[model samples]
Target: MSIITTATALLADIAVETDRTDAVQAFVKQETILVQITTADGLQGTGYAYTIGTGGTSVLSLLQEHLLPLLVGEDARNVEALWQRLFATTRATTTGAITSLALAAVDTAVWDLRCKRAGEPLWRLAGGHRREVPVYDTEGGWLHLGTDDLVKSALAAQQAGWAGVKIKVGKPHVFEDAERLRAVREAVGPSLHIMTDANQSQTISSALQLAAALEPYDPYWLEEPMPADDLSGHARLARSTRIPVAVGESMYSIMQFRNYLEAGAASIVQVDAARIGGITPWLKVAHMAESHNVMVCPHFLMELHVSLVAAVPNGKFVEYIPQLRAVTRSEMTVRDGVALAPDEPGIGIDWDMDAIDNRRVS
Candidate 1:
């Protein structure tokens, strides 16, 4: 058995491909925090996590100064045990953003190492339920886009054979959101699934009003209609609406998800690998969702989530939002409507070291 010999992390700032406006805010730079770990025997693994706009440095510092140090003499093969160790050590920051983000980096690194050692792809190693998964486009739907443009983008996605398109809601007036969705629904027709997101910008009254307005259009799910802390609100909203309440990207821990499931709040679980403390907890969340009879449709980082989604029985649609092109050498392989998991070893992303260096800011 080889012991871990080294650990390092990099901070890269990658810009959004487009404006990326939602109800809450526009995406700034992705503060990419990359983690690399190598064993005494020369086996290496790469893992990464990112902040949508800020805190990359804190996450990086946490990795370099705290988490990765713990990994220096640890067993590289004991992925779950390592995760528990990291989780237990970070009790002060439990259920917060920075600690989990740092934990995700190390947890993913070990999982990548384990997969590489086993000579198997992560999807198979994780669960291996399927090889390909369906995708939906979030790139085409932004809060800034107008009704005409929204309809055009939705139709384009439909023509391209994608399963669905997510449209941002949460306008000052619920009618405005309804109008855009109505126009898109009318143009793309009822065949294509239309997912709606409020980005946690709505209140109970407003969300219910918007839900009433959106009901006729048949949205795939209504995402983040309120604050993540409002578990009771989410439950009320879920019970009130015909649409499923999709959540978890805004959530960071498994216990939060457990509470949501126990309360019968979430209909679809968007268990982000980065936000959920990497593939280890991400899988736990997915299987947990399966037990609750809810489907998992993870948020962004489509490249990583594609394989994870394919790995589980309850996994559903993978959101297609390509933000890693500037840092990675390869794009996700999509054929017609489906995205395929990488058959290669490791975490499956081909990092362009030179590009990463070029994008490095700290």
Candidate 2:
């Protein structure tokens, strides 16, 4: 009765703030790929994946032309099996961003179906680990934000009871990034954790210098200090830094995490569920990270990640970046520096279908 009777895909082109810059690039638009599935028993579910700005149409094509077609007549409950099937079908596209993003859209829809059948929230059903994960503000920490503005943002986050505020590093000089971290630390007075994201924009040499300069300020973590592909370089940088190195937002697979963990290269694993396919593998990565004694503080899409983080014991901080307010019925609940995982049964998002239609691009 759980056989998937219908599967469909659509595109939502959402505009983001023009000034949201990281060390890598300024984000302009978000291409939200939404997938919906219906079971033979008449239960329905929706799931989605997102891209920064480009290649979203490619993801949509993969879904409509190839991936979504495979879901028909398949039991929606077979998460792992279906995921493997999709992976095998798209074997040529493995390690590619567009392919994984496409798979994630459908996989999350299937998860939404499973959760609905269980009558349990994803956080509890997935692991029942905990509800309230500590929250950190990344909206205030973009690299383009001025030092004075950085202080103001950090203080605002502190005043709002957030546990941490991330600062985007990678200025022209190591000292400039240090000065920004110093200002944020001074403004928050050291209790609130101050993390830094280099956005995988630095070279090994620059990362080493920046890490050394920021050590005095006691950053909670230094994230993506170099490119995600450079495993050996990351290992070397991790050895050199007293600060824990965090990575994996840009990574597209579980094997990449296996390599990082095996090498002791990254202390915090920022596995983005969308980029790594979906909730099925997301849990696998979380448990893998836990086994390695590494923390899991995922990158973005806080709407979905709040539940995922709450589902795992190794889950660390939920980065506060609200991206779905325009298309969702309500915002996620956060109070006193903690995010509460949704208690809803299906996928945890109350998507506004009309709004999604209005925003739909394809």
How many residue pairs in model 2 have overlapping backbones? 0
lDDT of 2 by residue, 297-316 (tens): 99898999999999999998
- Model 1 alpha-carbon drift over 4 Å, by segment: none
Q: Backbone collision count in every prediction? A: 0, 0
lDDT (0 to 1) per candidate: 0.91, 0.91
Clashing pairs in 1: none
Let me know the TM-score candidate 1 reaches against the reference structure. Answer: 0.99
Model 1 over residues 227-267: C-alpha lDDT tens digits? 99999999999999999999999899999999999999999
- Give the range of the ten consecutive residues with the poorest summed lDDT in model 2: 15-24
Query: Which segments of model 2 are wrong by more than 4 Å?
Result: none
